[model samples]
Target: MRLHVADHPLVAHKLSVLRDAKTPSPTFRQLVDELVTLLAYEATRDVRTHEVEVVTPVATTTGVKLADPNPIVVPILRAGLGMLEGMTRLVPTAEVGFLGLQRDEETLEAITYANRLPDDLTGRQCFLLDPMLATGNTLVASIDYLLQRGARDVTAVCLIAAPEGLKVVEEFVGDRADVQIVVAAVDERLNEKAYIVPGLGDAGDRLYGIV
Candidate 1:
């Protein structure tokens, strides 16, 4: 799988704030939304489009419009849910889907507790949104499910990732050219519990307040 790490000062600035433990939930949520928007722009660089002719007051002009097969945006709940609005703001035409995946605390294995995606995803370009990529089990499982349903291409967008997770996803995708990962930053490592070290810390908790 290919990887794209956003290389912009503004992105880095916002990420720094997000990383600070002192940032509150309200601020964290806002920053995440902004960060996701920036990453989505980078992640959708190859989103399918087709040439179109438009008639202006002066003359006819040619432009490109998003392709017929609207892209699908799936946000792994519930942390992933925080990124939905930011992603859709950029690709408003994209269809939205949901998947509830969480790691088993004891085993650190991803489990899909809920899924609400189309059965036939043939030719669809899907964007999977999740805030963190630490262990990668959830991402691998999510991609596998989308591929199983016939998704032709998949792009996963995350705010932060660990080296271990990146390696895991790369190995899991193997020679799948259609799969790619877009992240804001690759942190140093994963903690014992499989959390990204020096990460923003439990993105779900930071975004939505403790339950």
Candidate 2:
């Protein structure tokens, strides 16, 4: 498993505001979108492409276009839904899917309650969207779900991550398939309640009002 922490000033600027408790919900939501767009740009850096020749009025040139079996964007719902628009904004032609998983507060385990993805993902490049990587159980489960359906290449895009969470993913995926995590930042650690420390609290509650 590979980890990429975005290192741009814009990412840092927006994320600093996102960490503030006083930022209103409206501003928070806007920043999430903008920040994800930046992260998405980095996440899709190695997205599959194919070359083709194009003719201009004066000459012909070779260029690249998204390959067949276009990449699929799967946003882990409901908090993950907040990231969908930002990802699609950058890859408008990519197909969209959803996986709904919630963590058991007591056990810190992830349970899947919904799935709206293709039955077979044999050659597809999947991008999983989830804002926080705290305990990492939810992400591990999500990656397992994708692999079950034959997905070999999976990239998870998160707004922020905890070192503990990253280690959990790395250990679980050792020498397995191709897995990468792209995040705006990897904060200090996970708190007792499994929240990323010095982190923006509950992404779902902040994006939408408490639910």
Candidate 3:
């Protein structure tokens, strides 16, 4: 598994505002979209592409296009939904899928409530979207699900991540498959409630109001 923590200044600027408690929900949502787009740009760096022939008025030339099996974007529902627009804006032709998993607060286990993805993802590069990475149980389960369907590779995009979550994902995926994480920031740590310290609060609540 590989981890890439975005270090751009614009990412920091937007993330700082997103973390402010006084930022209204409207502003918070907007920042999340902007920040996710920035992170998405970095996340898709390894997406498969193929060279193709193209014709110009002056001459014929070669260009690169998304690979044959085309990547799939799977947003982990609710909070992850908030990131969809930003990601799709950058990859307009990519297929979209949905996976709904909620953590059991008492057990810290992730339970699948819904799945709208292809039953077989063999040789498909999959991108998983989830805003905050705290305990990482949910992300681990999500990746496992994709692997079960024979996904070729999986990359998770997150706004903020706690070290604990990174460790858990790394250990769980040791030499297992091509797994990676692209995050805007790796915050200090998680609090007692398993929330990313200095995170943008509960992403779902901030984006859609407490539910």
RMSD of each: 0.8, 0.8, 0.9
Query: Where does model 2 exceed 4 Å of error?
Result: none
* lDDT by residue (tens digit), candidate 2, 1-211: 9999999999999999999999999999999999999999999999999999999898999989999899999999899988999999999999999999999999999999999999999999999999999999999999999999999999999999999999999999998899999999999998888999999999999999896
TM-score, each model?
0.98, 0.98, 0.97
Q: How many clashing residue pairs are found in candidate 3?
A: 0
Superposed Cα deviation of residue 38, candidate 3 (Å): 0.9
Model 3: lDDT of residue 67: 92
> For model 2, what is the alpha-carbon lDDT of residue 146?
95
Model 1, 1-211: lDDT tens digits are: 8999999999999999999999999999999999999999999999999999999999999999999889999999999999999999999999999999999999988999999999999999999999999999999999999988998599999999999999999999987648989999999999888889999889999999889
Q: For candidate 3, give the lDDT of residue 168.
A: 97
Best by lDDT: 2
- The TM-score obtained by model 2 is 0.98
**Poorly placed runs, candidate 3 (over 4 Å):** none
Tens-place lDDT per residue, model 3, 1-211, is: 9999999999999999998999998998888889989999999998889999999999999999999787899999889999998999898888999999998998889999999999999999899999989999999999999999998599999999999999999999998899989999899999888988877788999999986
lDDT of each: 0.94, 0.96, 0.92
The stretch of ten residues in a row with the least summed lDDT in candidate 1 is: 172-181
Instruction: Indicate the residue-level lDDT of 156 in model 1.
Output: 98
In angstroms, how far off is 114's CA in candidate 2?
0.3
